[model samples]
Target: MITIIAAIANNHVLGKNNQLIWHLPADLKRFKLTTTGHTVIMGRKTFESLGN
Candidate 1:
């Protein structure tokens, strides 16, 4: 099985100026829980946002 995760904002903006709009602790927890023990795939930009 494959699982995907992404962060979105109220204006339907995934990213702006190559950054996240807000930080939601609940969403962060959910993302961590969902991607646990799994591989995550994303664009280079997204990876850069993670400081990878």
Candidate 2:
């Protein structure tokens, strides 16, 4: 199964200045649970934005 998951606001604005504007812990938990044990792919910018 191929599922595309995204967190977007009503305005369809993804991010500003390559950074997320809001912090949602619940969303993060859900994302972790959903993609657990699966190979997730993301762009370079996205990967870099989520720093280690």
Candidate 3:
């Protein structure tokens, strides 16, 4: 089973100007709870966006 989780805005925009449109705490919590210790998959741009 592939459980896909994502946040899509009303405008269907995932990002803009290299920043997240929404930085809600609940969203962060959900992401942490959902992907913790799990093998996550993302595109190159998404991976690159998360700088070290």
Go through the candidates in order and give each one's C-alpha lDDT. Answer: 0.77, 0.85, 0.83
Q: lDDT for model 2, on a 0 to 1 scale?
A: 0.85
- Model 2 pairs whose backbones collide: none
How would the candidate models be sorted by lDDT, starting from the highest? 2, 3, 1
TM-score of each predicted structure versus truth:
0.65, 0.80, 0.74
Candidate 2 residue lDDT tens string, 4-46? 9887888998788887667899988998899889988988998
Off by over 4 Å in 1: none
Question: Candidate 1 clashing pairs?
Answer: none
| Tens digits of lDDT, candidate 3, 1-52 | 7898778799899888867788899888888788889988988777797687
Best by lDDT: 2
TM-score for candidate 3, residues paired by index = 0.74
lDDT of 1 by residue, 1-52 (tens): 7655767777889877877778788987898788778788878887786763
Position 45, candidate 3: lDDT: 79
Could you tell which candidate, 1 or 3, scores higher by lDDT? 3
Leading candidate by TM-score: 2
Ranking by TM-score: 2, 3, 1
